[model samples]
Target: MPFDMIGGRTFYAYNSHFKNIMLKCFRKLSTSSSLMDKRYIPRRAVLYVPGSDERKLKKIPSLSADCIVMDCEDGVALSKKEDARSTIHQILQSQAIDFSGKDCSVRFNSVDSGLCEDDMKEILSASHLPATVHLPKVESPQQLEWFAGKMKDILKNSNLSEKLRLIIFTESASSLLDLPAICRRGVELSKDSPFKLDGIVFGSDDYCADIGATRTNEAKELSFARQYVVTVAKAFKLQAIDIVYINYKDLDGLKVQSEEGAGMGFTGKQVIHPGQVPVVQAAFSPRPEKVEWAADLVKAFEEHQRAGKGAFTFRGHMIDMPLLLQARNILQMASHS
Candidate 1:
């Protein structure tokens, strides 16, 4: 029998055939509405709080952001990495840090940073784990496979029924080039693996730095990277989180950029400041007109389906499976909002 190590402890693993059967059962149960609520939870505004900042951690329960990310990566200074890890671990283990109605995630350092191992060790050892771990600077599918293996070991060792999820941060030129492969691997692993890959986050600052591109208010330099991230994420049925708008003080500029990102198919935006959260959320939400149109399309499609028609005309456009799916998604998002 094979054995897996987690936090220095080893355990015997199930045989391949037994594991496959269990996975099929789990997938069936996962499709239930209650267990699948996470799929519809709107992540329009994912606010990043420095792990070293106790005040911000304490404020998480009261924040209105759709997702709160306790960051151990670029948000924390190099000298305070250990301190940040300790602080975040304490917060995760605390009962007062209630993330009941909101999504919670922790951003770990890059796999090659040498700091990620210690970060993972502390996180997996915690009595309470975040819903997801956001990995920065992912350049290949092998990196995701390595992390997934560790997560499986940890969850199995802890006897935790909740699956630990992952969000990949595409922060370098290499990651951009490997986007399709990375997304494919994530989707393939999610079917039978304990580690569920939920989303892809575009990190513009690091990406621009890596490519020697100038950062600007226009954001023309990042257009291609942003589109690629969103397109691949949608292709894999994963949420696409756009880069943070660094100008927290410029609410107007943030609004403009948020709207622009929404237009480009991004499902959410990273928020550096609490003030940016509401703007980002509002930007990604379906407008009144959009919601109305989606409802109409859904009704029309159902009527056509009842009449034994596969495709029908609506507003000078053909209504088919893809268009119907898009309409249903809008209504679903509106309900969550």
Candidate 2:
């Protein structure tokens, strides 16, 4: 039944309905963008560039890391720390260190350490800063909080007006014991009603040493810490990056480590050499089959919902709410990648 109306009233009603639909669609699109920008709980690959290495500094813009980290910590010698800091500053100043659509970060030594303070001063003094500043050897949220305050003051004084970010490296026994609580602090910081922590990376080698594990490339002894890191990162929805592969010359070793990390639910692994970038990228990038399967699940779930179904069967197995969430997440990772 239609109500009687003035001339051209039906056309006006149709136009109004179409506009409402368009508005709804637009809202969903905006939400999707936010989701895309939110860092993945599992960062598949992060490339580590030694800040002192002029050769590596020159190549940052073109690297394929999902997130790139310029290291001014363990990667550089004590005498070379200043050189690395100066190099990083010049690089950020003279040329654009494009992330190639990747998240960019810089690793300063422990904030409590003099070297790290100097590193921070150098970076904060720069007109341009990396997207995130990684604080190595973080043992607790308090350390993060302290570092956040320092960075805030620096950014304010510098008048950079930029949101200097924070990423903590958990490599000590104390850090391992407090991983979960610290991650919650990260979420709290990120919400930043006050201060926010951006992410946490597992400092694999150092962590292993702290735990009295043997120094080996096998990574067998690091299982507990590594798994705990991934779990905490997911629980708090912070990016969890893997440890760096130190053997720069062994591409095969890099591949092995990258694959292992990927299988262990790590979204990304750190690379010591530019040559290792492609291997890491390939390992972390969503597999084609996974993308296809996820796409199918999404399509099927949407179709079932449209048909007034509460659930659906896929490949002879019942698909439920949890599985649907997983499918959606997979699609999200694929899209983000």
Candidate 3:
């Protein structure tokens, strides 16, 4: 038998036919030369905190989230937008919030909101700039192009054009439909441009409202949209972050949803509450058994390659370049996590 029993469940130890299929699929995906760099930057749990809340801002240094997003968008009240921007600028400038080696980003309002320009201006003017800028409600490639153009001027003036990265949030059906094009623009911007497109985030709350669809605990309503985001992100080699789990009180539900998101190919999840951070991070991290298997596969593949073999058999399965790549990715993720 090619399967092995582990923890009372059957695991596919080897399957030559399945390996061949995966090899073909990966080869097709790799053909896209425009694919962005797939660096494993531990973005498993991205926590959002309202920028206007000084109490919350003060507490950020103690949190263990892989990425902290100081939100100036939907998280802030309309009347408090200016205050939030000012507060965020102060927090960044003070350098009082210790990132603890975590990535920091600021989510500005949408381009159409008429407040994004001011938000960018204030945030960019800070002495301690965020590593990334998150753009919400991205609907078209043109909007990204416009923002990129504007950011060029800001970053040029600040001398940080090459340092600041960008991650866009898709919150509407229109954005979902134009995902591929948006991702293409992202790739284009990263090349000889000031701002690099690091990833794409899905905002299910806004998307559900935009589509007039009711959200349920089962989450069947978001399957197609979520899968589309993951597919486009993988095609472009960008990170795909899943929607936030609003039910922060339900830890079990959060874990279940996080596992589902990870299974669906999302590299990370967004969280509103601090308690959800560890759960999401654990869910997206590589399993110990999988990491061990990946290491073994790499070792065997290397030995075979040293013998001048392009493809070889491993535990009753075919080991090829695609499979090698998969093993390497798994190892990389495990090491970073």
Candidate 4:
């Protein structure tokens, strides 16, 4: 006897809940000739903006990062938390800002943190909202569940699309221990809607401190956590973000780490400063030789397929299905950039 009241029409909830019925109704009402096929693009760069910094907020529209995270969690001081929240709200209303097409986001304090409620309320009030939400210091699945519920409530009440996404930062030992399960939670949340469970960011600085390790150029102590996060993310088909390189003045160090992260399968890196953006971009961009190899693979594969062959060899080496797929991916990435 479940029902919904819509514009004076009472519809049976069971029929509405039925997938086949819903699909028919959607098709009958849809006016578009073509289906909406939205593809997921990997976020290549995410720049962090301290919430309390007016200077940074003013410069956001001019910034060239794929995503911009207005951080109200770690970046703001205790005395400035309220002020930061105010600034975020004001920025949303300001006529000067428009992050519509960008993968704009905000990192709220962890649900366990007392500031989460206020942070959520402030974000919900923004007229110009972000496309995704970054959750910091997530140590357990329960925290993920709680935040998901809160986001759902916000969507329903605000009349905004519920396609909000979650990008978690695994910063603690407990979080690193359950990286695989955490990624699973994201997939589960995205089950029935465009709303997504996106990525897991490895917070290297906090991770090292939690494990009693120090930040070094080698990053030997953080290697296990870094590699584990990337593995779990790939398993779930989610984005794996590398940690931010802290030394702003050390462009060489940043480039080296960015290269290492890219070679290790990380899709992107967290940039702490504007100076690091070009370095990360350069590292992530496909090289000329790799791009050329990808082009050759595609040509060879097409020819083999035309000849009724399932596989082909290229460059005097044995090339197979998996390598062909990899080459195509590399080519696609290069073309997109």
Candidate 5:
């Protein structure tokens, strides 16, 4: 009741205060910064642009990353949330930033923050809707339920395909514990609504602080959480985004982490700086040799299937349904990349 009351007041203030998330720009009003619809939009570099920074906001048009996230959560100071919200809303509503061919998004504060409702309410009431919205600090499937219910209500008049894509951050112990249920709920929502649950992003810094763990050079401490997020994502066929490499200047270090995350089956790695974009994108992309191998194996698997065979051998190795699925994922990444 309190949450709804706050949002109710916020929605009125927004439009009256003069309203507006990563809004994928659609073709109807498509300018040089419009986005394309693809079932497999690569999120190899999920770049977070602070909503409060005018300089960074302007630089968005030039960035080549797969996804652009205008942050309203941890990236912005508490005092600046209102201003950040206004700025991002205007940018989306007026097409102030050029998001051409980009999967641009906006990140709201957590439901627990008491700021998410206002953030979401203002933006959802805008003339233009974001293609995606990022929700951080999720702790349960119930939180997702609350979020989805609001999304469906706020954008009831917009086109479903272009409404919004939701990617959540699992930053707490409780969230990780309930990861399966949370992601499963997301899948269930997608099945019933046009507002799709796009991906799951692992928030390492917040998770560590929540658990009182020390940050390390190797990042071995997060091994379980990282891999677990990816495993659950794959089980439901959702996009799995790896955590960001905090050291923006250390390109080499970032590359190593990006590759490690990719090897663990993460579809992408979050990046804090523009310099890290290329390395992350390259690291997540399927290697040419691996793509070829997958293509050939898939061909063999199909042929074997047609010939009434189940288990098959390809390139001197035993192959099964699991391996075949792996091949398909590689090809999917390659094609999209």
Candidate 6:
């Protein structure tokens, strides 16, 4: 709030303690290891294809993204909203695209926007359905509840074999603040619901606009919000999606940003361009060195536990429960990647 839109230095200066704040946030993040033991689908690179773009839509089946989001929200223009919905509906119904081994999603307008009903109506007309629906700009738990009820009413009689998963965007101050409550509430309602809350995607551009955070080349302005979203999302056993790299032409910069997000524990990234998918996919994957370490650690952990060994030092670091869980996660990722 203290800086101009293009001036990020003044903003960072005021929030200089964000590093410490992020550290504190992460220190309190880990929950029971049983949460980590649950099966999670890989969402390493979430590629958003505008529903109105026929060229991109035709090529969607060829893209190797872990998740494909047929977007009818921000990516579509107001004038083409109906057209986008029609196009997406046709694609799903026609089976023009083979989405085997990949997760498909549709991004509807925010629940508050009055356009979500139209989006739902389009989906209802189709016999086919996406595995996920992305809800952008959802700031409160009530909105999530509303969507759940609305979706149940609309899709109750549909012949969907899989329960649809919902992913919300965390790009506003209110969203960042009430995120935990939203997830907790969603988790509660999900136990018996037709649709479930699955993950949170960070929309940095809208978030910065909402909070008046100045722009930065490397997005340092979004550092705290980014890390905080990942921490809270993981705490509630939900996948955390990192912000999109707007400069699609710069694959190198995108790689750095993607890797940074991965190191921060984001399970996936939002990609707008085809070129960015492979970079993000590789960035989110386990490296060979790390995989070897994880493999060795898993063996050590198994042996030590079988031999009645408690927390012991491995490679000069304490192999506690959290690290052991992390090691297991790495191995799982290694096998999947």
User: Residue-wise lDDT of candidate 5 within 27-98, one digit each (tens)?
Assistant: 111121211232456788899999998889999999978899998987899999998899999998999888
- The best candidate in terms of lDDT: 3
- TM-score of each predicted structure versus truth: 0.80, 0.75, 0.80, 0.76, 0.78, 0.78
Each model's total of backbone clashes: 0, 7, 0, 0, 9, 0
Give the range where candidate 6 is weakest over 10 consecutive residues by summed lDDT. 3-12
Query: How would you encode candidate 1's per-residue C-alpha lDDT over 1-337 as one tens digit per residue?
Result: 3344343222335455644443443344335454354445568889999999888889998887878889999889999899999988887787558887678889999988988888988876788888888988889999878877766666676765666677899999998999999889877877666757888999999899999999997799999999999889988878899988888888879889999999999999999888777677778877757666776776676567569887689999987655655665666555545
Instruction: Let me know the TM-score candidate 6 reaches against the reference structure.
Output: 0.78
Error at 27, model 2, angstroms: 13
Instruction: Please give, for residues 119-229, the per-residue lDDT of candidate 3 as tens digits.
Output: 988988888899888999999999998898877777675665335778899999999999999989878987866778889999999999999999976688999999999
lDDT of each: 0.79, 0.68, 0.80, 0.73, 0.77, 0.78
Clashing residue pairs in candidate 5 (N, C-alpha, C atoms within 3 angstroms)? 20-123, 21-106, 22-104, 22-105, 22-106, 23-130, 23-131, 24-131, 33-100
Model 6 stretches with alpha carbons more than 4 Å out: 1-38, 289-332
Q: Which stretches of candidate 1 lie over 4 Å from their true place?
A: 1-38, 159-162, 293-329
For 56-112, candidate 6 gives per-residue lDDT tens digits of 888877888889999999999999999989998988888788887678889998988
Q: After aligning candidate 1 to the native by TM-score, how far in Å is the CA of 5 from where it should be?
A: 53
Task: Write the number of the candidate with greater TM-score, choosing between 2 and 6.
Answer: 6
User: TM-score for model 5?
Assistant: 0.78
126-176, model 2: which lDDT tens digit per residue?
776677777888878787677666666676645434355566788888888
**Per-residue error at 75 for model 2, in Å?**
1.9
The better candidate by TM-score, 2 or 3, is: 3
Worst 10 residues of 2 by lDDT: 3-12
